[model samples]
Target: MSTDEHLDPIPDSFILQPPVFHPVIPYGTTIFGGLYAGKMVTLQGVVPLHARRFQVDFQCGCCLHPQPDVAFRFSPRFYTVKPHVICNTHQGGLWQKEIRWPGVALQRGDSFLILFLFENEEVKVSVNGQHFLHYRYRLPLSRVDTLDISGDILVKAVGFLNINPFLLYSPRLEVPCSRALPRGLWPGQVIVVRGLVLKEPKDFTLSLKDGTTHVPVTLRASFTDRTLAWVSSWGRKKLISAPFLFHPQRFFEVLLLCQEGGLKLALNGQGLGATSLDQKALEQLRELRISGNVHLYCVHC
Candidate 1:
């Protein structure tokens, strides 16, 4: 199927024009009409009011419902701005604003383009080819399955451009320590960690060392297909499928490691391309345990 065919269709609440209408509002007007539907579109217009706001709806397949994703607010303090695409879930509403180009001012005869790549979880908003904002959904955009555009602002020309899914682009990953294990992991703490698989199926063992007493904590591996198995501690185990290639380097998983530094990771001891600790304030080290459904095997630490 074509790329556009894979994305959600645009609703009919918008208009495209070369001679677009420009509304005149008072200096302090805050409310206005808006265009509320489309996957990928471009809008050009002049701001008659001193300030305005734009809202858009977004949904992911893995998520529950459509949520407000982006808002463009024009103000003196926030001039020439680009809003980030909000992914509702994952990493506490992942913000991919770093991938976007700096925003530009809105002026008469100036053109603006807002491109949404649903299949690839990316949004590019540009003003006159000068990239203003570019953002990517962090957690594989399983939540957003639909999109809607709406807002009230002076518009001169509006155009809808459907994109092919394969043509979608993702911004570079530059966050330092994007997938490091948590420092202080206490009881009842839910943490998620992702990292590249440097070594697959390495021995993952947890032992408690208390004065003359050492015990092995059972560790397991979970395969990618959701199968489970026990990993022998002293065996040369191959966790991932041999001949595994790590292209796209973004492969990782999240672990809900609880208190006592008890590891709750995929069976293969592999790292999820990314890791996130839902709660920031976890207590220091505690005893460790190993027992659970193995999710992934053959992973790098």
Candidate 2:
């Protein structure tokens, strides 16, 4: 997909589950870590003008002959006289009682959004933001791991939104992104940045700034000096010396943990070092700015 199509801007305040873009029809893929209560699945697509029917199946597995048990089958039939939606489950190679909701809200030849929200007891479905129906679980939700979609629909994107506090995930985020720190910097909070260094790298910096636009803390990864430097309003305290991990064409994750003393730093998952900051200064921070030679993937606050 083109960069423009993939990096559609979303507000930084709310974290999102990474979305799948421009997938081919009859698509089937394993859910990242499987579904759980409070999780949601979103599908964006257009129904073919002459489409007869289409179905989205949440299956235990993509087995063929034995026909893996289907946790949920969401089908929209355009071939019907009045048009309607069908919900059902398949287990032991038998189809369960059909649940029908008449009067389909979807229109052919137009874009649509389908949301499947998983709850502890049932799956709530919404069509283009309107609540449509609910289906109670027959098979264990834990057994559902694969998503299979087929039929006459022009699929655009499919996204999974996992519930997490102060976290966000985007398959791809535009570089030079700045996000707000709504709760400000506080003890016991963590900010994570994941990205790839440009092939021909230059200095890249992640900075925390106050509402007044004054930067209080900044971490710079310099290729020329091959060092990671921590700088703040006080001074450039020290540099993370030799064998720096931020290299050209390499993937890296930088984590900053706010603590009582200051901030704990980590490169990838390993401890890099720590920096001390006055609680007053950390509390004043309101935004995070990232710039220079990096392609961002996800950012969590």
Candidate 3:
């Protein structure tokens, strides 16, 4: 996993948010779109200087009396002589056998970036860009909807980001890649492109085309002028111009969500709004072509 220096001070209105969060402890929020493989939960915060212990829980619900089931409980304790991390589940009001990892990676007063990558059968945890541990699922992952963080820690930001679009078998895909879309465009399907802009980027374009070499839609990110252009062939028109999101030598995740009307665009988890294209034009899209200044990491539809 690559780290982006620009990722900190996340965008104010991103799908992955609790942006500029209130410095209050015991933070809780709904995991928008729920838990799924390739989804990432990111938390940026610092451990309180006097912190004794803190826990992050993924729960099925937020019920009080009976207490909703906790699919995953990740707790780090400072009171212990070794300062270890405990991972377990709470089901039917009982705690399951715990798996303890001695020596917590996080230390008091240290600002940290924690990422939880959800996989089919487990969650991979990373702290400050280093692999921390893996916690296998004890309960059905689909049941997780809420994220709860309690105890002593200062939270800066939290984000629920989607990546790897359709779960490619290969970890990454090469740049200037082209793929055929046999079924054309379908509503609810998403196209995700993750990569790093070149040190001196010129521009990049992600386009959808038909067999006759006609491009129906193209999203062009221009570093020269720092603008994102939405191009369409329906009327040979440029739909709109959005603020350029890609930065030279920075990691970026671009998401294009197919909808009945058009595609919803998001950059690095921040929703950039949408554009409307004809459904008939979309249905004729048989190819996805990406080219220009980037080191591609992954691309899936």
Candidate 4:
């Protein structure tokens, strides 16, 4: 017999159409079975713009799946909805809107992933591998333990899969106190930094060079209450205070990293100073802050 002849016929309950298939599982059917009761699970679906609502159906246990519980609904716009084991409605119609998935206006064949982390405090939803939504539960999970799927769309497939909560990557930052500044320095971002200063002279200056204009970057003493003030000069003749005294051979090098929120100062890879910065100063730093003295080389501030 031919493979087609031996294959089982599509179920009569499902409507198999070009866009919406019945005998075949729809592209957006909600799946709720196999380890989907109390643990978190990852949901994947292909959504066509016309699919209005997507629902998952599951069997509920009296003491396992509770009623009037909040579930985290995740998409581009995150939301919260209450789901029941038997039906979508609550005591009355109070949660009708909450239980129904609104039309997302997705394009045909648009695929997306929804991560539902059902925790004690809230149900966190991550979409497309990014953090998106959080929903608090009003009803306890002990009362309802079943899952169900229903909506104006078809679900291709649904499964309960394990996920690592902390498998995410972050970037590193570096900033110097006496050399050229790095790129991507903004008012709110943090920077890693390193530098030098003479203590004898009461007045010391540090200027971040940017093109033709030299912008003075603020420098605060990490150990003491003393603060250094600086001004940018037009020519090579930078101004210096005569009262400033320096140990003839006691030159120091420091690494200074900073963000608009705060700064950390290090010396030769060893930490020396750290402090929180004023919000106003961080917002005004349009140009990248460079290290080094004005007498050195010109930098792109």
Which predicted model would earn the best lDDT?
2
TM-score order of candidates, top first: 3, 2, 4, 1
Per-residue accuracy of model 2 over 172-199 as CA lDDT, tens digit each? 6887889999768899898888777889
Return the TM-score for candidate 1, rounded to 2 decimals: 0.28
Candidates' TM-scores? 0.28, 0.54, 0.56, 0.31
After superposition, candidate 1 runs with Cα above 4 Å error: 1-39, 57-103, 107-111, 117-121, 139-152, 156-159, 165-301
CA lDDT scores, all candidates in order: 0.33, 0.80, 0.78, 0.37
Residue 220's C-alpha lDDT in candidate 3? 85
Task: Kindly list the per-residue Cα lDDT of model 3 for residues 46-133, writing each as its tens digit.
Answer: 8888989999999999777898899999898987676888999999989999999886678888777777888899999988767899
Give a tens-digit lDDT track for model 4, residues 1-301: 7889975453321111111113244223222322222344444556555554455432233222354332322323222232211113343214534432343334445665544655656666555555654555544533444444445444433434322112111111232334444342454343422122333333333344444344434543322323332333333232222112122222222334555564544322223345454555444444444433211111223
Error of 1 at 163 (Å): 3.1
**Count: clashes, candidate 4:** 54
The predicted structure with the larger TM-score, 1 or 3, is 3
- List ranges where model 2 is wrong by over 4 Å: 1-17, 164-301
Q: Look at candidate 4 and tell me the lDDT of residue 139.
A: 48
Spell out the clash pairs found in candidate 2: 15-168
Question: Residue-pair clashes per candidate, as listed?
Answer: 45, 1, 0, 54
